[model samples]
Target: MTFKPFAAPTALLALGACVGRQSVLDPAGRDANTLLTLFAVMLAGLIVLWLAVNGMMLFFNKISTRHYDESTARKLIVGGGIVLPTLVIAALLAWGLSIMPDQRAPGDGLRIKVTGEQWWWRVEYWPEGAATPIVAANEIRLPVDARTEFNLTSAYVIHSFWIPALGGKMDMFPGRETMISLEPTEAGTFRGQCAEFCGASHAQMAFDVVTLPQDDFDVWLAAEAAPAMATDGAQAQRGAEVFLAEGCGACHAVRGTEAVGQVGPDLTHVGSRKSLGAGVLEPTIANIADWIAHTDDLKPEVEMPAYTDMPEDDLMALATYLKGLK
Candidate 1:
């Protein structure tokens, strides 16, 4: 077989062309760009080394033993093997370590506790000089440009907390706490997921980090800490009755009420949340109704059973009452 010196370059160009058309790479975020650069450099170096090694092996195999003895071939092989591998590995290690963010001091900022459950996340904000922590679930809010420290742990199973745009991942193990700190430089919502495989509903276990302005974050926190409001009008009032009658209180908690079950996400301010089903669906009346009707469809293998048997009118009323909880 003949040697193809241009093969590696052509293959790299082809791969680059394919990636250039991808939506994930087109408008690449900060973390994406960083990872891409790292991968590109590593791949290019490996391809070049592979081509060089294969070319040399082929050339030596074709040559005569009369011209080059065993000692010469051995020397060449040993030198190339030692030097090339050492250089490549050292360069890669240095490059990788250089890209990692400094973890010594991310600065004294907001402290937040993140606890991972089987299929949801509970977040609590501990602001400076606060008597009690402000608690919420599935979604997190932060002030843009403010450095935030997250103390993460798992309540049930082992999970990994990953928000690619902000920083790297941190593992959450039961009884063991890990910390991750990041300064969200932009005001936007970033998607996060459990990078580790946990259980049946692992794919649906997702969350969002919303970076807001200082004033907006303050307002949101104050509102979230307040008590749940009572539903008004005849339909909502009737729905509130349905909420209690349907036995929804078994696994849900509603502030200012007798429902104190902690198996599920707190419904004290479910109406105020941006999304439902642990960020699987938006917080719309229709979405809530669909989720309440068939939660398994929205989140497969979820612990919450489907309420499809419930009457349509009752479902609508229940959704309305839940939406009015804010």
Candidate 2:
């Protein structure tokens, strides 16, 4: 039996996944656009050089040896092989380096700090001229056409922060801060993940990134800054009681409620998020209940303890209550 190479088809499938979301090539930010342009230039240069070399090789193979001379050899060797490549490489290097510093966020822009933990992310925003920081988790929001600075660090192991639609990845190290900046030019929702493998759940450690217009972003920030909404329905009240009684409050916080635990993702506005469990599943009542009952099934090797012993009705009530948090 003959074996077929799977590389080409696999590559094609991966390329197909590059356009809709999490694609650096389909850039929505200034930095990603610059990088994409550079990549295109380099790829074009490579194709040109490959064609030129192959064409020359084919020509030489077909030519008679009698026309060859020392001078011709010297010209081809020294000029075509050495001088041209040297100048081309030097120019490309200079051009590439010059564009790198442009990725830095300008002096006047939004500042946010991201701390990567074991399988999750903690996000804090420092608004302009504000004394206190706005804390959130798992999702990030950006303003269109506004420069945003990210201060990255890790609470445990090293993790990489990356939003392919926005910019390049930067490592978050313990006790040291790394920075990167980007300005989104469009309004859309993108996906991001912990580019570094921190633990067993690394593949599931994802986040949603939403970019909006300036006025919309301001409104969102203001709403997120406020306290959590109160539960009204009797079922939601029962769920809240179950949430506290089940000891879920020790690791999560739903602002304005008894669930003021900081060890896990903030649930203050969890219901408003586009996805749940760090993008592992959709934000729905059933999924939330499943996550509570079997987090390891949805995301293997997660640190969250499963509530498999809880009754189905209680789980449903809890999920309903959490969903109403928005």
Candidate 3:
């Protein structure tokens, strides 16, 4: 009979772990699981304490007719209020602090750099014995069951990078570097977003995270490190002209080509990215056309200019060319 009141609330809390995509309750990595464990321990302790106090109060009220000595009340106050609370808090603090250092990356693990920008994420993979890091934007791919270190930074304003299912939130500040390491336990896809309020399109800034086997991850890194593919058809060649004529080269870059602008994300492998505009839309030709024609309509205050003035055929060619870069 006494346990009935806790049934519904406990059920709901247990069900919270099944939430898909971005739930902290559904932790998938070691670091996040450790946090979830700590939360559960604290919750159980508090609930037991609360029930004990309430039961004592009810017992006292019913025994009001009996002789109640001041010495008993003094003993109860000292034991419950001071000693009990101090011991519980000290134990909880010690457990939580022990989980902190477990999230650090190993000394020789793979390294990746993430730079937070106004409405996008600049991603780079540092492979073994490579002259330059493989660059991508708005997405990260990691090998499952292997430690991966992340060097987080920001170019413009302060931004917080977070993937709730994976681990903790870390701040990215200009001119300073912070680090967080994560090792996914299984192969799957997840979503990441900026936790800080940076600017007008702060809500729109997001990225995709993918985990794969070790062998698959190595193959992907090799492909990403290669030069951008040359256009294969006349239509694509013509589209390259449109990209240059629209002054897109002034801010964006495509590797192995003359379009070298460091201000925007690298489009060397744009066609293969899962989502566009920092995970706002699906990567498709029609969506690409819409994004190019109405850049500000989709993402307000973005630095990219609108290309509504472009000819429909030229726009199609440009879209096809960009899509083929994968």
Task: State the C-alpha lDDT per candidate.
Answer: 0.78, 0.87, 0.85
Q: Give the TM-score comparing model 1 with the true structure, all chains together.
A: 0.78
How does residue 16 of candidate 2 score in lDDT?
80
Q: Would you give me the overall lDDT of model 2?
A: 0.87
lDDT score for candidate 1 against the true structure: 0.78
Q: Report the C-alpha displacement of residue 116, candidate 1, in angstroms.
A: 1.9
Better of 2 and 3 by TM-score: 2
Q: Tens digits of per-residue lDDT for model 1 on 145-246?
A: 666788999988899988766666789999999887766656777677898999988988888778788889889888877778967988788787888888
Candidate 1, residue 122: how far the Cα is off, in Å: 1.7
Q: Give the TM-score of candidate 3.
A: 0.91
TM-score preference between candidates 1 and 3, better one: 3
> Which residue pairs of candidate 2 clash?
252-261
Q: Write the per-residue lDDT of candidate 2 for residues 66-154, one digit (tens) a residue.
A: 57688997887777667776777787789899899977656345799999988888999998788888889899999998899888899
